[model samples]
Structure formats: structure tokens, C-alpha cells
Target: FYSELLHIIGLVETKVGGKRLIERNSEGQRHSGTILEDTIIHLDSLDKISRLSKAFIYGETHEERLFNVALGLNITWINRILFLKLLEAQLITYHKGDKSYAFLNLNRIREYDDLNRLFFQVLAVKHEIRNDDVKKLFEKVPYLNSSLFEPTEIEHQTLFISNLKDEKTIPALSNTVLKDEQGKKRTGSLSTLAYLFEFLNAYDFSSEGSEAIQEENKTLINASVLGLIFEKINGYKDGSFFTPGMITMYMCRETLRKTVVQKFNDLKGWSCVEFDELYNKIEDKKEANEIVNSIKICDPAVGSGHFLVSALNELIAIKSDLKILQDKDGKLLKFYDVEVENDEMIVTDEEGHLFEYNPK
Candidate 1:
């Protein structure tokens, strides 16, 4: 799905190339409702191309660099939007399926301008100081103090999502996830904005408590799924190597478990070879949690932080095994079993039901 979207992003965006020009009628409007005609590509003049290359903020290099910039920006927007989808679903679930926080729907965001307002006015700005009109429209929307919501340095110089034409439509991918009314895969062209949102809504993005595999349920995706998606998109441009989930799981398990043991051994004089040994030695849950929390882990080239997420899961599972996994008040969740499976942190009660978090 993202691979197809990347193609469309490149087609519409990028200063070097895109929907460059279209035939205009005598009325000074775009030519439409006309018979089909063969259109030939022309580059009789290099003036437009030269101007585009000159605007490259990274460096005065080949015009092809614009593709890279476009790819980067597209990835940035994709991550931000996907995160918002998760946030939106989580809010609705927390509020017992209230539709007010559902901002990703078609009604709330019909065009790029609406999305632009959401990015800058609604989310980036603080709640109190937001414009009166924006506040009234997005009253239920909380201010998200994230740099992701802010415009990038490249955006200041070049085109953004808002700059894209609402009327513009791109040829749908042959292998599109979109389905027709008859439930067959859709073809032909579609507005990129609608395509994106429709593709997103095709699957169920559940933030519900039940992780049980139901045949009726759509694919379940959490943060780990986003990590994989980001990694896959990274491969879209240069055929970059994607570290597999098996590799990440193994790497985190092998590295973090030993690191935890070493940290505890270093802090205390206990000569334990394995992390599990600390379980018996641990007495005060507070002190053990303190010791565990002191351990730091870092990944120098964390592209999508897949490794980091796996490592975090390992830490949590290790803490739980050591009986040191505590709430903010340092109280142990003794009845809960926390473990990492398939790179996801799963919490189950004594009866093995998925644990649901309800905000207090």
C-alpha cells in the first residue's frame, strides 16, 4: 500500500517533475469533458528544468535530487498521518467510541487545505492561543506538541501537501488495495487525497482491548507495524536492506538480556551470570526498579527504531520476570504476565486475557 502511495507522491510532488502542464481552453480554465487525444511529451526548452534545480535547498546538484527531497517529505507526512490515525482511534476508544476525535475521516478533511489547517493551526499551535475560528472548529482536538506537526525546513522553500491541486488525479496502481462496489480491486484514476484516506479506512485500526484473532476482524496494527511500514518505505527508493523482525527480535533478546544482567551485577556486588538470577536476589521492588531504570541502551543508526522498540519490549519483559515491573508508584503488577512476542509487548492477566488500559 505504501509503495503505491510513494509512486503517487512522486508523481504529484517534487519540483523536478510532476503534473507539470495541462491544456487550457479559451475560457482560461483547464480543458475538460473533451474527446481523448494522444498527448506527446515535450522539453523544447530547459528553462523550467533549470529553475527547478536552482531551488534545491540541499545543494546545487542534479535536478533528480528533488525526487529524494519529495520522498523524504512524503515519508515524514506518512508517519505523521499514521500516528494521528492511531491517536484518533485511541481517543475514540478511550471515550467509548466518540466520533468527535475522528479527524482522519473524509468529512473533516476533504482537501489538502483542511489537512494543512490541522497540521499547523490545530495541532502545532498551543490550545489557549489558537485562533478563534480554529478553536471553534477543532475544539475537541487537543494540541499535539510534536515537531512532526510543524512544517519542515524544505516546506518553507518548496511545495507541500497544501500546494497540491485538489482536482488533480493520479492513475491508480494496478495492484491497489482499494476495492470496487462489487468488492473487486479498483482501477483507473482517483484523487490522491481520497485514495490515501480510503486505503487507510479499508482496514480496521482497532485500539480496542481485544487482541484475539477474530476471522471477522481486519488486520491489527500497533506501533510495531508502523516501524515495519517505515522500514519497507525506506526500501522503496534505493532497495535499502530491511532488517527482518526475526533479526530484530533475536538481536534485542541476545543484547538486552545480557546488558540487564551486566548492569545489575555492576550496581550490586552479586556475581550473577544470568538476568533471571536477580529475581531471587531482588527484595525491594522500588530499589530493583531503580537499578533497572538506570540501565541505558542506544542504537546509533535507528532508522525506524525497530531495534529500539524490540529492546524496550525486552526490558519490560525482563523487568516483569524480575518482579521489578512497577507502576509510577512502584507497585508491582504481580498478577499480570508481561512478555514480548512477535516484537509486540503483550500483557495478560492470570486467566490469560489481554490486558486493557483504562486511563484513571
Candidate 2:
């Protein structure tokens, strides 16, 4: 199944003139397909391309393919660099031999202890402030406003910073030293923060080229995929696996469909088994609005929040469909507003009422 999908993706790419690569079957037969010009494909389709390429060329299993794809695009490497940079700047500290640096008690840092915010500050100062200028920036750590160091347009800066801030608590190597048999000191590859930053800066995460495949679908590379990649790279001890978007979507849809049916049927005193039947039974727009708004979704073990995101998108879609039943006044129903707080999706109605979307 994986290999067949890979052949199709290669064919799709070639059809769109994305690459000169030719698609072939396992039996060494060339394969071809047609895709309409200017048609936008989703990121999931491209992910299949990455997965199949790894599996066919490297003999990687589905799990291995997912890990490799995640590692290639993960931004957690940046977090490690930022953490070490903060330590070098004396803005934070850890006990000797402690692999983790605790930000909860950093006295010098007065601003929000958000690692994402700190990274933005670093990017902002990377070019404009240097040498002795950095000393001044760190000297007033707690009072340092990242906004003061904005380097580009507000929209661009916001997108880049938000992307970086998607995941929390990336695995990083401890700065502790080791000695060989000859008593020579040895350190982890990531111990040197400067070298790591230099390497990371070479890859332009914000460039159109970096995200071209995803942008073709009017989306960006999944942050959850990147987070999983970082976990694999850092050798995360937990046995957690990255759930594919397709699986997440299916699970969310089925779960939400059942829940919505039950809730609506119970509310309207109707015994309907189908979602469409439930929708048709509920003639009151206000009642429908209440039912939609009251629905809360949670993913208890949310990692990278793929499930929650899928649920949110599904809910928004369901709400839009329900809007068709709205009267002329109900047509003024404001579009759903969504925000990401602490990596969870927070959706609200036009009246500014917040719906809970807890993913812990």
C-alpha cells in the first residue's frame, strides 16, 4: 500500500512539473497519471510522497518513515540551540549533571518564560544587535520586550515566531563533560550552541522554498510532524508515535459524529441515528447554534495536537454546514474564530464566547 502510494505521488509531481523524476512500479513498470493544471494538493498527499520515498529507497517501515520525515522538518533543534544560548547568556541555569534547565525560576528573565518568545527575541537580535549589544539585551532580561527587536513586517514576524513556538520542551543534551581512558575531555555534539545555531541558520524555515510543497496546498508543513521528528532525533524515551493526519481525521469525524447525534437527539427529544436526520429534526436556529457551541472536544494525550486540530477543523466544517439551515437573521452568524493557546485550539463564536478544547 505504501509503495503504490509513493509511485502515484511521483507521478503526480512529474505531472505538475515539480520534478523530472519518473514513477515506476515494483515490477519495474513505468506508471503515469493525470492531474489537472493549477490543482492544489494537500500536505497529506506530499507526506505520502516522503513516506514512500523513504520506504522504497531505504527499506524503512511505516514507523521509520514517519520518524525520518518528522526529524527532517522538526524545529526542536532550534529549541536546543535557544536553551543553550540562554544558558550561555546566563539567563537560566541548571544543577551540575542535570540534563534539564528549569525556566520556572529564572531570576534574570522577567518577561514571560515562554521559550517561543525567547527564540523570537534571538531572531530579532541576530542581525541588528551583536557583540556588546547582546550584553545590553540580556542585562535587562526580564524587562526585555521582543517587540523592540522586530526585524521585518509584523505579519511575517508573527508567522515565523508562531511556527517556532509550536512545540514545548524539546530534548537537549546536557552540557556535562566526559573523560576518555586518557583523561581527555569529551562533550556532546550539541554542546556548542554557536555551531548549532550556525548550522540551523543555514536552513531557511521561513523561505518559500523550504515550505513550497505544503504551500502548494495552501498550507504549511505540519508542526506535529516536526515535533515528532525532533522527538526521534533527540531519542525521546517515551514510546509515543506520531498519528497520521488521515487517521486523526477519521477518528475525529467518527467520534464527533456520534457525540453530535447523541447530544442533538437528547436535546430535541428525537431518536435519530443519522447526522443528517438530526440536523433536519432541529428546526430552531438558536437551538442548533447552542448545540454547536456547546460541543467541547478533548484529546487527553495530545502530542503535537494533530487530533485536536483535526477535530477543530471538522467542527468548523460541521458548523458551516449547519449554517445553511439558518434564517435570514441567522445568516449574520459570525464566522468561527480560532486561536492557539498553549498548543491547543481555542475556538469562539462571534459573540466572543469561548469553547473549551482541552488537549492535555
Candidate 3:
């Protein structure tokens, strides 16, 4: 993805007086495809990119700065896209698996312009005030009041998604889940946008823990897993990735469990060491909740924020262990048990059914 995006940035630069030299001896035959080597550019030398390079990148040379800028832009775009992918999954889950609200597919967003509008005009704006052109085009895609939908500082100084040509194809990754019709792995290239949407579509982004799986086993990609992935990918330049989720979960449980115990012991004369001990001693759920709320956590690494998410899950699981996890009504979730297993939070009933969040 980063490889293709390097060429995209260069292509975008060409609109604003940036020069591009199609490599004469390039591996890619002069086809209608997007790839990095196809369009070689001095992006850092360009005025627009230079401003961004100066503002964000700490690299010394033009080549260094150019690569960093392209990478940052590509990652930012991918994150936003992934967020929407999850959002689409959520909306579909809410509507009884209805596909009407799904906007990430090529059918709804046929080109980059549609995606651009989805970002800046449709999701970014309130539904009532959106342009009729896109509002009708994307039915039931509600206005998600999220910063992801808003244009970033980088986008303000550069081209939007609509600026990139959509008819381009890019080489598929060698290690790919995409397969060919001969019941084998696909080795050839694929249309850029088509591949992205289809790749995401193949996975099940089901937040609902209660959903049953059928014959076709699908990979479940949730927010926490996505967070781990994004953090790992973003930290590739730094040679750092997420402290494995198991370790994170264990660390959080140990730290938070001890901290909670200490706070209770200090405040009261209760010499509780285990979370289970506190369950019997605590009288008021509100007081216990306030105590838990007082605890603050910070992951100094701050890579993809997976650590913080782990801490959050740990807190919830701790509360569940103490039998104090409650709903908006102050009624305990006695019917369910929330546990952190394999670094993933699972909510199940006494009968071992996963708790599905169906607000509908």
C-alpha cells in the first residue's frame, strides 16, 4: 500500500507544478497502474510538500523527507479508511446485517471522488445539510461526528482522496489472501480500489460477540485487533511494535489490580490483596466505581495506543471480577461475565453465550 501511495503523492504533486519522470527502464510497463517507481519525484523540493516536510518530518535529506511524508500520508489515509470499514460493519450489524448503509464498497464509492465526498462532505457534515448529490448516493450513511471524518492538517496542505486517479491497478502483495479462480492464490495485480474494498469485505469486523459463525470461517477483526495492527504498522519506521497484547493484558491486570487493592486498603482498614476479597467487603457500587475511576493509566510507548486500550479492558474485567460492573441504571451485569482472554475482552452469559451489543 505504501508503495502505491508514493506514486499517488507524486501524481498529486504533478497538479501543482511538480514534475514526474516515468522511469525509462522501469519494471512496470507503461500501463494504467499505480506504483512507486513509475513516478519518481523530488517531493521534498516541491513547495507544498516542502512545507509539510518542514512541518512534520524530522529527516535531514530531501529523499528522507519525501519518503516519510508519503508514508505518513498513506498511513493516515489507511487509518481513516479502516475506521470507516469498522463503522460500516457496525451500521450493518445494527440494521440486522443490512447492506444498504454500506458505503465503503465500490458500488457505493465507485471512484476516489465518492470516497472524498464520503470523507469531507457526507460523514463529516450533518445529514440534513449534506449535498443532495452525495446524500442520495449514499443512503443511510449517517453523519458520524468523528475527527476521522474531518480533514487533517496534512490534507489541508495537500490533495484530497478525490485527486488520485481511480482506474489504476497496483501489484498485489506476494503473501496475499486474495486467490485466483483456479482455486489457488492470486499472483497477478489487482485494481487498487477494488482490491482494498474486497480485502476488507472478506473479513468479519463483527463487534457483536454473540454472532454465530457458519461454514465459511471468517477472521474477526475488532477495534482492539485493528489498534494493535495500526500501531505495529505505524511504528515500522521506529523498529517498534505493540508490546504483545497478552503481555499488555497481564501487565494491566497486575498493575491495576494491585493499585485498586492499595487504594482500598489505604482508605479503609480492609487488607484485601485479591480482587475477589474486595467484592465481599465493598458495600456501595458507586463508591467502588469512583475509586476505580480515580486510577489513571498511561502507556509511555504511545505507539498505536494498544496499551491504553488493554488497560481499559483490564479495568472493565476487574470491575466484572468484583461483580461491580454495572449498566446506566446502576444494575449490575450479573447475567454476563466480562473476561480478558488472549488479550481480547469477551462478554459471555452464565450459559456461555457471547454478549452481543444490539442497541436496536
Candidate 4:
């Protein structure tokens, strides 16, 4: 059922120029018009895929299932091998002549299982490994030789990981044995370690939106949701939950906003305005940049470093905006220099810049 849905989605996406097919309404009426032209379009492609899979798995009648199957075939395929390419990219095997398909990366699934088991084992021994610790471990793992992260960022990450007090336990981590769901003893192998590293490299925790606030907030939500899912799966009954990104952003923004208003005292109408708007209204670009630079943010309960990360991003964004405003008015701001490489903007500002930017 899952395979068929993927094929269907791939077919529709190719036919409609990477747009997903519209779903049916409660009355069983298929949605009309192109995705963009329609009044409402589904943004959750993953959920749509799941629903399509469920329709085939537990449809009420043969016609209901056939309706979904027909939806898959409605598209006209100009590029017949597009679906095959999609399958290949997803690590799914496809036989062209026989039209057979299967998952090519069963080891990836096992890798996840191994990771979960490892996490439980770690919890048992160490109570909990801080998210930063987990991040450091990923940094130290030599398997991630790919250029997915910036050179400087990876170097710093590696250094931090190497300096960890428990760094010596990583090798033993892979070799640690634990009981499985069936109460059978299992030990993580070298292959499990390889898959774990691969998964970490592939998983992205950065924002990818044009709007800084929206993008960063979205990333926070995604990370928090994953944390929640992990907690639920592990049956964490401590009532400890991650702080939502929105609340963190709001708190950080408000803190910065109040500090700026208190110190500067030149800007008015800040109480009712957004941070970007308030920053834009400030005429002193240098002072604005200084204000942003001087403000120190700390999150004591820094689970996953979400608050700190978001605060750093927010500050950088403010500086970037101020720099842009300065540039437009032919004014020079002393604090930061912008370099453009490979059609991407790299801002080097202040002594400590958080995170590396690698735009896609």
C-alpha cells in the first residue's frame, strides 16, 4: 500500500510539475483545479501520503479502493521514468522490466531501532545525555566526512566532541548490549554505528525559509515535535516536555525588545509593533547593531538549545536587516562585513557567530 501510494504521488507530481493531487471532500467529490489554482492546497504532503496509504489499507469497499487507485492513474505521464528516479532517490529499489519495487535500505530501519535501544541504555546508565552531548557525539563520529556542514562549524563541533569527558565511551556505546522487545540480548554492531552516523548527517535541524522568523520558528516546532514523539515512544511519564518554539521566540523577542527600548529610549510606539518593524524605525544603524550585539541571552533549561539557538538567529537577523538598511542609504556599519560566495551571502559579524549558514 505504501509503495503504491509513493508511485501514485510520484506520478501525479511529475504530471503536474511537482504538485500533489488534490484530495476528495467528505461527500466523495474529488477536488478540482491545479494545486496552485485551488482555493486551498494541502501543505502536509506527508499526511496526504499517509491518508492515501490508509485508504487502500482499510477502505470500506472495493469501489473506495478503486477510487484511490484511479486517482493515481489519472495523470498523463510524459516522463515515464520519473517515478523510478524518485524511487531511487528515496533509497527504494525499482525493477524497470518487471515493474517490481522494494525498499533498498532495510538496514536504515534497523539503524533507527538500534538508536532507540541505545538511547534507553544510555538513559539507564547516565540518567540522560544532554542534547548538546548527543550533538557532540555526532560531531566526533568520523563517518560524516561529507561536506554537509561548513568547515569551521564542523571543526568546532569536532573539537567540542573531542573535549567531552565521556568521549572515550563512544566505541563502547556501539558495543553495548541490551535486551530487545522480546527480552533477547542485543548488541549494536559496527553497521549500526555506520547507519546512526548516516542518519545524523541526513537529518537537518536548520531553517530553510526566506523569512527568518517564520523559518526559525518552523524549525523549532519541527524539533520540538520530534522530541515529543520520542518522549511518547519511550513512555516518559515525568511530565517533562519541550518548550514550544513560538513561546521561546516570543520570550526572547520581548526580552530583547524591552532591553532595546529601555536603553535607546529614542524609539517610540515599540509596545505595539513587531521586532522587525521596531528595528527598521531606528535611524542609528550603528547603535542598533550595537544594541543587538550587547544583549546577552541565556536559557537555563536549554533543552536542545532551542531558545539560545533561536535567540542567536534572531540577533543575526536583526544585524543583517540593519546592515541592509545601512547599505541602501549609503552608510557604513562598523560591526559586520558581508561576503558573497557562490551566490550566497556570508555575514561575518562580532566575535562569536552562532551556527553556519549553508543555503540550499
TM-score of each: 0.81, 0.38, 0.82, 0.31
**Model 3 regions more than 4 Å off:** 1-47, 50-58, 207-211
Q: What is the per-residue lDDT of model 3 for residues 11-88, given as tens digits with 9 covering 90 to 100? A: 221122232222122344333344222122323334555666454453677555545555565667778888888888
- How far off is model 4, as Cα RMSD? 20.6
lDDT of 2 by residue, 121-162 (tens): 543445346336334544333333444334333223112323
lDDT of 4 by residue, 1-360 (tens): 112122222211121343323333333322222211121122122133234434555246644444333332222110111222232322211122222222113332233332332222222233234355343332212121222222233223112111112111111122223334675543442332232233222322233222344321221213344433332212222334555657766776667656655555544334533445565567766666665566666767554455676566555555655463255454765566543222223465576352233423
Q: Which residue pairs does candidate 3 place in steric collision?
A: none
lDDT of 1 by residue, 125-155 (tens): 9889998877877777888888889898756
Worst 10 residues of 4 by lDDT: 160-169
- Per-residue error for 122 in candidate 3, Å, reads 2.4
lDDT value for candidate 3? Answer: 0.69
* Ranking of models by TM-score: 3, 1, 2, 4
Select the stronger candidate by TM-score from 2 and 3: 3
TM-score, candidate 2, is: 0.38
For model 4, the stretches where C-alpha displacement exceeds 4 angstroms are: 1-191, 194-238, 266-283, 320-360
